[model samples]
Target: MTILLMLVQIIVLFVLVMLHVAYATYFERKIIGHMQVRLGPMQVGWHGLLQPIADGIKSFFKEDIIPEQADRPTFMAAPIICLVAMMTSLAVLPFAKGWVLADINIGLLFIFAMSSLASYGVVLAGWASNSKFSFLGGLRSMAQVISYEIAMGLSLVGVMLMSGSLNLTQIVEAQGNSILGMYLLPQCIGFFVFFISMLAETNRVPFDLPEAETELVSGYCTEYSGMRYAIFFMAEYIGMMVMAAIGTVCFLGGWNGPFAVPFFPPLWFLLKIYLFMFIFIWIRATLPRYRYDQLMDLGWKLLIPLALVNIVVTACLKAMIG
Candidate 1:
């Protein structure tokens, strides 16, 4: 009975996440369009509300193309690997107190592990496609994820130090006890580093060299088409939401707002997540892509070193406060 209940929960969350993934693209297009002072998706439905539904149908019916010489198995499996890994991270996130799918002590670490695993999908997709552009993009992405991932992980050490636990729920509670009611005030350094790393981790603006259309044409998944192509994009957006959720939990006081909704307590949680998503779209609209060399240098020569310093400083402060 317990197992069956858990399975039902998983299915529901997965469906909700897929719906969010679809609407996120619509939101991005509309946000970017408005940013550029143009009407976005007006023809689809009432300011493009139903655009995501149309897109879902279109992608479902589109032809699935594969390179004649491509490694069919790996090519087919890559997007599924990437998408599944990302969606799994949502399991441990605390939407509200005790509302998590899995309330484990090492939930934070599980998320980090899943994120690392997602990189393998990118690597395989590029190699299996057998295109030079795809291969180079994949290699670049592998290196990019590896480099910035170090910075991102190290930056979060501060949050762990303050919370005194790897459980994300405890982290939010820790922020609540703080006078400012958010780690954003005290963990400013970590927050800054984490946000920078988040953008790079998600292959968002200023760090999207892997898919820079001017150079790589389409990056690691360049050979994918139709639903397979849609899957890769779904993974990207879901990955964005996951990172934003982490930021919310770690820095923005996950679900800890000024007031709680009487009947809908998770309202605050959803609002914070949406705010972070908007920022993701905002940056993509505003910033130019970083050059590959500059991107690497930022990760290695700057963010990592800064992350290291933040860890040391955070640890010292926590020790002193106690």
Candidate 2:
């Protein structure tokens, strides 16, 4: 019975996240449209309010096409792998005071591990497609993820050290007595590194070299079509949400706000996540894509060193105060 309950919870969470994944794209389109001073998606349902639902139906009906030379088994598995890994990390993130799927002690480590695992889907999608463009996109994504992952981990080390706990909820609790309500002020450097790295992590604009439409013709997913292709995109948007959620936990003070909502307490949490999501969309609308070499330089030359320095400074301050 207990195992069945867990399975049911997992299914519920998965469906909820997938729904969010669908709506995120619709919102992105609507937001970007308004940003460019154009009406976005007015045709579907009530100014395209139900556009994502329409899209899901269309995707479900679309024919699944497999390339002649593509590795059938691997190609099919890649998107599933991506989606599973992306969702697994959400288990440990606390939504409200007691609302979380998995409140594991080593939640932070689990997230990093799941993140590393998620990259395999990208790499396999490229290699299995048997296309040079896909292969290149896979390689670029792998390299970019590896480089930024190092810096992102290092930046979070400061938070981990200060809180003395790997659990995200504990980290938030630690911030209650902090200089500010959040780690954003003291860990500004880490926050900056995290923000930039997260954009790269999600393959968003300015760092989206892996999926450049003009260059790689949709990058690693050029060969995919129908629901298989849609799954890849779903993974991408879900990834963006995961990163935003993690950012809220690490820096923005998870579920901690000036005023609490009268109804569900997680409103503060959702609001912060929404703010990050909006900033993500705002960036996509406002910024131009960065050149590949420039992207590499920004990650390795700039963000990595900054993260390291933040760690050192944080450790020294902690020692002195102790």
Candidate 3:
């Protein structure tokens, strides 16, 4: 009975996430459209509210194409690998007190591992495509993720040290213990580094070298079409959501707010996640993509060192205060 209940919960969560991922596209387009001084999607439904549903239907029925020269098995598997890893990371997130799919002790580490695994999908997609553009994009993604992942990991070390636990829920509770009710102030440097790394990790504007259309013709996904392509797209959005959730949990005080609603405990958590999402779209509309060299330099030269320093400083301060 317990296993069955868990399975049911997993199913429900999966459906909800899928729905969120679909609407996330609509919201991103609408948000960016408005930012650029234009109406986004007004065709599908009232104010284009149904656009995401329409897109899902179209992508589902669209022809799935495979190149003759492409490695058929691996090409088909890459997107699945990517999507699975991102979805798996959601299990450990504590939506609110007592609201989590997996309340494991090493929840944070589990998320990190899944994130790293998702990169394999991109690399595989690039290689299996048998195209130079895809290859370059994959190579770029590999290097970028590797570089930024290091910074991201190091940046969170402060949170780990302060919280003294790897569980996501405990981390949030630790923030609740803080005078500010958040680590945003004390771990400001870590947050800064983490924020930048989050952008790079999700391949957002200025750091989307992996899929730079101008040079690599959509990067590693140029060859994908229909549902396969849609899967990759969904994975990207889910990745964004996951990163937002992480930032919310680690720095913004997960699910903590000025006031609590009796019916909706996860309300604050959802709002913070959307706040991160909005910033993502806002930046996309505002900033130009960085040159590949500049992206690498920023990740390796700037962010990494900053993360390292933040860790050391946090350790020293923790010791002094203790």
**By TM-score, who's the top model here?**
3
- Compared with the true structure, what per-residue lDDT tens digits does model 2 show for residues 11-96? 98788888888878888999999999998988988999889999888988999989999999999999999988988888898988
Q: Which digits, one per residue and each the tens of the lDDT, describe model 3 over residues 1-322?
A: 9899999999999998999998989989999999889999999999999999999999999998898899999999999999999999999999999999889999989988999999999999999999999999999999999999999999999999999999999999989878568999999999999999999999999799999998899999989999999999989999999999999999999999988879989999999999999999899999999998898899999999999999999999999999
User: Can you write out model 1's per-residue Cα lDDT over 231-316, one digit (the tens) per residue?
Assistant: 99999999999999999999988887898788877788889999999999999999988888899999999998998999999888
Which residue pairs clash in candidate 3? none
Ranking by TM-score: 3, 1, 2
TM-score of each: 0.98, 0.97, 0.99
Off by over 4 Å in 1: none
Ten contiguous residues minimizing lDDT sum, candidate 1: 259-268
Candidate 2: count the clashes.
Answer: 0
Quick one: RMSD of model 1?
Answer: 0.9
Badly placed stretches (over 4 Å) of model 3 are: none
lDDT of 1: 0.91
Best of the two (2, 3) by lDDT: 3
